[model samples]
Target: MTKPGAVSSAQLSRRSLLRRSALFGGAALLGPAVLSACGDDDAGATAAAASGTKVSTVFSWVKNVEWAGFWVGDDQGYYTDEGIAPDWIGGGPNAPENVQVLEAGKAGIGLASDTLKIIDAAAQGADFVMFAATLQESPVGFAWLDPNIKSIHDLVGKTLGGDSSSPSMIDACFKVNGIANDYNFIQIGADPAPLANGQVDAILCYTTNQVSVLEAQGLTVFSATLTEFGVPLYADALIAKRSFLDANHEAVVRFLRATIKGHEKNIQDPELGARLATEKYGVDLALDYDGQLTENRKQIELWVSDVTRKKGVLWMDKDYIAGPVYEGIRAAGRTELPDVNKLVDLSFLTEAYDGKTTLLSA
Candidate 1:
């Protein structure tokens, strides 16, 4: 979500509203010839750029605590250690879509949040390739003030509020439970104040964002995540043009190596990570320090999994993609699926970890 100002009732509501209206629309692909977007011998030039291999990475949102790991990696000189130089481009409500930037050669790599939209682009023949997913589980959830609504099924007959994606999530949840759409869903523009004030039964929100804000206001918020409802979708995917990866495979691996180190640093000390964002990288954003710290702690919860614990952070599981990820997308509305093989390539992360779960090697 895009932040407006410091954490306050007005800021929180504004931020959530901006996030809801942020719908993804497809951008035209420029094709393999678009490699010119990086200039001649793109790979060679990137490797030889003044300080180190210059790699411009585009993100789906602003330079806030959401990307603390990357900021930490840059600040810690992790990229330099790997003979790489990173140029971070921030995206937000007014920015072009991540894929559009990649297509236009404005960025070599991108971090995107919409898995279904990525598949749609690939299905339409974009050269995008997802190398890793930062968030292994979807954080989309329904928060309610009622203690009686313990699970998803408990809200079958209740009124729900959410943004554009909320309906798909609800439909997917109901599809899995073999139940009909029995609830009244109004697009409340991602505001949970209605739920808190008893105007709506539930409102869809991210536990890391809106829920945290409500709870910080001393409201007892009970929620269930999409994964908990049997629909797991990936978020914050790291992607790049297939042509770029084909030419600079080694650079991609090194980039992941440094990035994983950054995440490890954040996981070990979240307070320091929060400071890195609010105090340095995102200083101009006027981000709330305590809010960012709380978000950092909550965001960490979505980055790890049993798969990641064994394979390392940002691990790509083919089985998981083919199963839950694909199923969740299908339930959401996309029936035609892109081949998972073309959509994801795990070679970069595989080489980055080198048969080890932890990159530092103790």
Candidate 2:
């Protein structure tokens, strides 16, 4: 019953950035509170800060606060502290992973949502695996508030938003509800203001993101979690090649160490990261990023509810990672399914959180 749609292709050009400093708005609530950990050496325990090892990583997108840890790690010199020099890579439209980059040993790890990338690479003579996931609540659901549209049954003829950014998780949820193909989606940009502004009845959205942004802006959204209604799909995983993991286990562990520190910082001082990210990811976000630091903080906190909050817990679920993922993607008619295991690897996170420090406690 799961069904997905083809994402229209686009180019990967860095767009012109519009800057809005929350501190400029004059509202204390909008301004990011100065946090104590900005440059604090909290990572002394986990990161060895060794030098001479070189690495490369490509980000899925730029300016999304989700990857703030990478920036903070680079800015805070966490990677340097670990003694590894990382050549942070960039991504844009049609990035297509360029598996050869990691395959030919040009890069050490690749970041993706699921093991699909890794699995596909394996199938194609490459190697990869997903480990830790950044976004907890996948946020793959419909964004609508029309009283007449309480459930999927009401979506038969309504105009749903669409775009390559549309999530396959929504398809899984809709299939579980036995409502696939019930409505039509109109493809648009990543920004879902059209749905919020009443341009359409609803928009497929990520709970951890777009809908949350809209709701915080005084717009209420009626949402359905991908797992809540039906299929289970993991989102935004920290992935690396299997061979790479076997070879760079220590470096991978350090990468997770730096990343865990960043996420914990995001959880503890969300405003600081969000504000810095607003200015950091200049082209991606539409709203004032600094103004939305509180929003980002709230969104990230809600992302890791009770279950995933336990110390040393990385939320590793193979069924969630491999199952409905390909089901929905194939159903949605995506060209091919990437290798599930290739898209994921947990050793990094396992080693990262296995330390004496707890992300929840930190």
Candidate 3:
């Protein structure tokens, strides 16, 4: 007898509607023509010539509600006003990874979320530095059905399913709680079938993503954000190569200024982005309006924090990174920890807001 809210194998296909594969470092490289700029070409070119430089921003995911701010920014002419004709290249499961795009000089800015990967690339002499983050804290976490699995510690002797990055994050979580790092982990991609049918106990997921999919399919899923599990990472991280930063510092600041305004717009009208993504930006993907709206609302909660209220939007705290973030990765068996200062630069965001928390007009 299946318990209430338990998902069966027959219901697995329901999740495919919102299933998004995690972006890896070695995905196929895509060309510039894949996704055009969200901004007007003629006007943006003129503005680029007058004040800002043209930049390419390679997104880490599909052009769904995840990129609502960028879409809003383009629609509002924020990028053109800042003199940037941004080519908003969208990424998907088969798209080029941000690291390769940036390293190959294909993009000036890239959205990367994995802190460990950024550090690893830096160790290999990639010369990348994170400037701003869309979400103040990571939304990635574990989703489970067992009522017994209340806290992260409860998964002590259970089989967990996740993508490629789950093991290190779990190791980090265990280390922080002073729990013995002992558990079974398997790469199960993004499906919740194994978990629903009892092949695995839990699966790593994003709060706004897979969890939402499960709930939409009549499954009541309990989840804990990555911060609660001791791995507090900044998601939707905006990164660029050091040389690009050196050459186009002001352009980068201008881009962030415009992007922050777009994010502010998203906060005011969550459904606006969902509509934009569904009707226009991601129209070909056949995204569900209601699902995107739910994801946007959930993401808004992750975007703001006490730090953002004081330091301004997209603020990256060095101390926070040095403490919990680095500790988590290092505890996960990583040997070298990159210097936080070298890995991040908050000055770009500082210049964008001029020491204020918002650019929205009152």
Q: Model 3: runs farther than 4 Å from truth?
A: 1-10, 14-52
Best by lDDT: 3
The sequence of per-residue lDDT tens digits that candidate 2 reaches over residues 20-81 is: 21111111100000001112212121222346365566555433455555555655666676
Best first by TM-score, ranked: 3, 1, 2
Candidate 3 overall Cα lDDT vs. reference?
Answer: 0.71
**lDDT (CA) per prediction:** 0.70, 0.51, 0.71
The Cα error of candidate 3 at residue 193, in Å, is 3.3
Q: Which tens-of-lDDT digit does each residue in 245-264 have in candidate 3? A: 88888878888898999999
**How high is the lDDT of residue 241 in model 2?**
57
Looking at model 1, the pairs that clash are: none
Q: What is the TM-score of candidate 3?
A: 0.85
lDDT of 3 at 48: 38
lDDT for model 2 comes to 0.51
The C-alpha RMSD in Å for every predicted model, in order, reads 6.6, 9.5, 5.2
